[model samples]
Target: MTSTTAPKPRLSIWMRIGAVLLGLFAALLLLLALFPWDALREPLNRYVSERTGRKFEITRRLDVDLGWRSAAVKLDGVEFANPSWAREPYLVRAERAAFDIRLWPLLSGRVVIPHLALTSPTLGLQMEEDGRRTWALGKNTSDEGTVPVIGLMEVDQGTLDFLAEHLGVDLHAGFSYDSSRGEMPLDFRIKGRYQRQPLMAQGRTGNVLQLNAAGQPPFPLEIDAAAGHTRLKAKGTVAELASLDGIDARFDLKGQNLGDLYGLLGIALPQTSPYALSGELRKRARLWEAAGLKGKLGLSDIGGDMKFDQSQKIPSLSGTLRSRVMDMDDLGPLIGLPPTERSAKAIEGVAPPPSITEVKRARRDSGRKVLPDATLDFERLRAMNADVKYTAERIRNVRELPLDKGSVQIKLKDGVLTLDPLNLGVASGTLAGAIRIDGAQNPAEIRAALEVRGMQLSRLIPKIETMRTSFGKLDGRINLSGHGNSVAGWLGNASGDVAALTGRGQFSNLLLEFMGLDGGEIIKFLLRGDRNVVLRCAAMAFDVDKGTMNSRSVVLDTEDTVFNVSGQASLSKETLDFVVRPQPKDKSILSLRTPLIIGGTFAAPQAGLEAGSLATRGAAALALGALNPLLALAATVETGPGVDADCQEVLAQAKRPASREAAAGAAKAKKQ
Candidate 1:
């Protein structure tokens, strides 16, 4: 003790200086804990601005609490400047924001915020066409230290706005948050538009902090939305806030028309009747998929698989879908038709539901809505490229048009869409065709080519007694081009050629007698219920100009007569006007009818003898337009004004190029 008393030769000067510095640091920390933080507001804001490369300011008040274990820094009326290119005045603004920092970390010049709270904050976000997002914040730099950890976060009555001009997206939403539970819970509501369609959603999320936590998998979410009459519900887990890099979900959808989903899913689809569906959804990296998809589309049952790849500059979709018997009317909404037919009960409180025919008449008379927004949805179309194929085992329950099965191949690249080889099975025949659509064009360019072969006349025209269960082969082709938003609009601006011909077949004696020059046969047909008459041939050809189809030639040859017809059908106005001239195969003194005229709309057709006919003084028959097969005969009929054809000659003439049998052969050859 006595030797140590030397006092270690008094403390070294350097050691004393170090001790003094340590005391000063402790005193500095104490001063920091007690000092008036209001005096340092300006310097603090400047420091933050310098570090974040954004302007920061506190407009109203600031409060600081320092209790080591429970320290906080609160500021009121704070705002951060937006990026130079942003449209908003501020990137973020808050009425009151606070941070709870760990004092121990601060001593080492490190920031460790255990909690952060924002009250009435507003945030702005944007995404450019080049894929740059405003929320990217700032460029990162390498540094060595323990990064700050935000344990809990809360937001009260906050709002966020986002825009993606190229994607036709402009959305705004309100949000709130609470972390009283183990996992931070969040609730949000959105109302605006996406891809130029109205959008709305409500949802809740949990474990949002996991988005930034180390070794965390994903957050849980639940959301529901209504797009027009379509309703969708989803619940799942997700990761990566900026990009859906990891996700898993279960979803269900219900709607009166499936076409409404075109807007919701940003896909091209024909309209369908009421439906319900459920499926599992997943995302990994840049791929999103919907698997085990099962649903009802219109009146048909459906199931399939779908995938979307978002890794590329442009998203692409690939999928395969199939269905059992589906009704063609299910596609009505695709053409801008309403989900349900409007009724007098809905408008004027009429008690009774309108009859199907009445509803149809009303719709036909009023015309369709015809593409509510005629402009092309270019963004939706160009947002992704697709390769999808759909097949239906049967297409049924439509009048006159019985399609047994069909398949369509859909391919899209950039803004162009192509449907190649759209094939459908008819009675014992087939209908094959293709359609091309170019959305890059201002008005959208459309071209279609369709061919029909080997259709049984009786099956094709079951309701027409004139066919009298006729057994024959039917064939035809249509090549057309137009520019517009819908079929109606396209036809209004169309140009095309249409032709059809029928092979040797039998007709109902009632039809032949009704149009014959022999009065005795007409009387006999009236007495007899029904009988078959030999049909030598039938043909028609037309050219479409501005929605009107002008006849080139029309002819029908039967055992007892040759009928030449000329007509024009207007698609825009839906009217048919035609003339029929009959030539008797055998001279008869009882002839009483000749040269009939047909005129009317598709809903109502009227036929009567023309003024110049020998029997013009008498009333004419009320049936005629049912003889639509005559439209293709325009190119083949060689009969002079008053010449009649022998059944043998007509049959021999049916062997020509435009004949039904020849046409069928050509179609078959093309397929082979």
Candidate 2:
């Protein structure tokens, strides 16, 4: 009871100095294995090259395994000559170097990094091609500050080769990191293979990245990435990222067959058909400018919004796009047309004696129409906000022809281009119109007007294959106006007016079919099943600059034949000249003055019927008196009466046969 009981609890004095420092660390690991570790290998290679400025070589079996808190140094190679970047010197070549120097966690101060193993490591990176980048840590070692954190590092099965001559990349990677969370917890894994496929990634950060680290969440982070068929995933939280001054991100990206991620990043990307993306990104930072970005993108079904200014070099964009229906014959191989069924089999392989100045320059270039460079610009185009629709069963140049419905909307500023008035129902009629295009200047001007109603002259004459003419239940109404700078000066300054009404019709070979004549005699006719053949035309309002088509009236009806047709058509060049006069249903039956030369070139025309019938004008003066047999002895010595008595009765009726049987019975009664 001497009350000095505390004297009994005497394991004190720092427990006898931790039992003599654990028996002097077990006798210095048994005298460091019989001592002669090559005599401490030159002061442990000058203390690992003065703490890793990097250049050390010490290997001859120096292994200290104090009950497995190991240490191994079997490295016959170690060279890191990047005294902060020359051109290419970040050399790291290793073959086994394991270390774990745990001296009771540095005598309980606790900054334990108990393991670091590297085996077979070789890393190389270089970039130079005017865009110089050889990261042996230079640029004055990144301006001499902040880059010294080598905690928890490991690499196994490692091999990395990267080259980026200004982005003509070549990369092969495999990496990993773990910090064992004594202070802030971090874990990372990266796997690789480039051109030959396979790549993977994983990440976790901060408060042991939660798994009951007391439900940790101070700065959670998650990441996932893949290669080959590409994929990416991300999760956020960086503790308000420096007070949200920058780096707030959300992302999701997916790709499968993005043409195999553009052939594993060699990039050529335009064989379109499989895509995916998702997004949200916001960034801000400024201290003499360095970061600012705003983004929202959702692709492959399109969506967009973007802005950038921190070295993103002038970017601005806004977007809207939706597509479901498309196929205007695949737009003729994207506008190099000549495939519309091979240009309609090259105009049906034309070869029907065709060369009347090439069929009058193919009918004066048939309404000369050509327009396609693809521009229907819109600034405020609203076809009900365009959820527009389209469908097609047929679209033809070689004849499928049914395009039952259509839609259009267009608008353009300053130079005007507006067209949103189209009400269509084609293939036998019901079309409406609206047009305006005045491309401001230089060879651009057009004014359109199309109004076709109830039009089925055999579905608009097979789209005018040079109008192989047809007419059957066609009620017409067409009014077209035009201005030009091309398309043959807009059809030589077009002027149109056509009115047709047919219940039944036939007019074949009008001098071989409407003045294309060619060896005529194929004049079929039938349009009087009850009178309605009327053609009232106009062009001579002062020759309309000589495009001439003035036939005030051309009436012809026939249940029993009656003709009173007047004409004056001179479509300029390529044959169609008329002066026909035949008004006979007994007006003393002596009216026939056909001096019609329906010329040529509208595809083979040549009709010159000039026999004004008074008996071939006396048999053309007896064949010019037998082509001057001395003018047939001067016409038989002027067979009396000044040798002109109607050419001596045309050589006495050319030895008549009842006046050639009454002129072949009145030309077979005037062709029935």
Candidate 3:
């Protein structure tokens, strides 16, 4: 047994292999410890330069620490060149930088950086107006490359210069990190110009270490920025700062005009007066929303929720706006009208400091024109599409306009805008209709159809005591179509129908006498208290063509008199030519039944007697009186042979044919 044992517990195959592997591993470790990683500086630079299509250089030394799980890389005086078109020679530079990269992914030719640190680094970023960006590396303008996953980052006294001509931003900022701030470490301050306005901004964010962590704690953020007269303040948290993902923030914004935000936010909006708003801002992929909005737009208090979706080819905006009490003047800018003056306190809710100066606006020549003449910008309409709903429970500053509540469904698409169910509560009635504006058409085309129903005359003429006792309801409709770029222009070239009718009502005899210019009736009513006359029916219809309004039929029948009106008015010229002839039901000694002519410009209308007809009537009256005083009454008329108009037929004819057809179609569709 001793002899066999001594023959050697011959070493097993495993032991022999173990001893050889140990010797080889020791040699390999020794080699790695002494290896000159600096020798790879030129080769690595060339390889990176070739991959990125940019110059890469290591001006000083390079060192690496290899481990089983990861590798630590340190570079001294490294620079990465920018695109040839860039203003700066280098896109990024660092005096000293270091990175800890995971080992496993390297086997698959992937880079996974666990940590990155930079000392005295500088970065230059730029974007051309044509949408070219220097940061899009590899192909210079191409965004076709995998970005390395970075876990944590640290920067010391970093400087960044960013320019984006399209957005009108040229900024120079300083960035730094302070570990003492705990979860919030990154801080920045910037001063430059945004939207061609002076800009100053300061912000702070959570530690970069948590930027990509799974189930990461919210990245705290706070920013206060001001540009020109606009100011923005936000405080919020982001789930991931890299892509601005999962943002939930509260923000306050103040500006001169809402439309001015287009260049900054890329959202299309109509021009508006000075405004201050606050809301909760959120982002989910390509959708950005401002919710719980409440603020002041000029003297109007506004509340709404607005959403912007960038996923669409032309981008879209949709929102619901509501106001408990809306000031009508605040809507002027939306329709290209001048804003009326209002107390600043009405908008700000407080007095401003003396340092703030009120902005002055140049006065436009009114020329006593009743219609608005401001030109519309079709380009703005073509920029984006929209669907919005607005409702006002009560209206203000409508002084004598008899407006109450209002609501409109606004839709815009492909340069065309439609306002369906544009409703206004007026004088205990409703003015309901639809309006379509095709801005895509050259010079633009507008079509409008409106209906008025149950408008009480008592409420309509609130200032007139005689009207207070009248129980009359007015019904009317307007159907118009035109091509223009302004409200005035549209009406000047408009082709349409305007009709109004009233049935089974009463009129003040005194008022009708004055309107008909009956001197005898006026004197009689003055002697005896004014009395009401039974109104059988009153109807007026106009057919408009090429801006000229021709009276199709106009008649007013009452127990006391029958009036017929005939004339043609020119909307383009803003002139009127009308004649009213009254036939009295009874005769009087002083009756002067001469026709009355109304002719003049809308700005300065003139009303006078038809002198020739009056002279003829007077001569006839005198001749008749010479024969017999009683027979002279013939000139003044005695028999009121005016037949009553078919109330139903008159009202039906007053409605425009186009509108009637549309209503029928809508009803049919609803039934189907």
lDDT of 1 by residue, 542-576 (tens): 66765677776567877777787888888777687
Model 2 pairs in collision: 509-512, 509-513, 510-513, 516-605
Over the stretch 1-672, how does candidate 3's per-residue lDDT look in tens digits?
355434545577778999999999999988888999999999999998898788999989989998999989999999989888888787789999899999999787566787888788898988787656776645546442434676666676688898887777899889888878666678889999988888999988764534454575667888999887678999998766566767899999987678877767767787776778999999977788999999987777789999988888999999999988888667766776555556233445333211112222223533445566778778778888999999999987776667789999999999999888799988788899888888999788888888889887667777655443575788887777778898888878877777788877777878777766666778787888788888888888877775777776688878777788899888877889999888776655455667889998886789888999889988998999999998777887634444555667766665543343333322322221
Question: Which pairs clash (backbone N, Cα, C closer than 3 Å) in model 3?
Answer: none
Residues 4-116, candidate 2, lDDT per residue (tens digit)?
Answer: 53455556777889989988988887787566655666787777566545555655545444445434434444544443433345545566665555455545433333344
Clashes of each: 8, 4, 0
TM-score of each: 0.69, 0.24, 0.81
For all candidates in order, the CA lDDT equals 0.69, 0.40, 0.77
Q: How well does model 2 score by local distance difference test? A: 0.40
Ranking by TM-score: 3, 1, 2
Tell me how many residue pairs clash in candidate 3: 0
Model 2 Cα shift for residue 575 (angstroms): 30
Supply candidate 3's per-residue lDDT for 120: 84
Say which candidate scores most in lDDT: 3
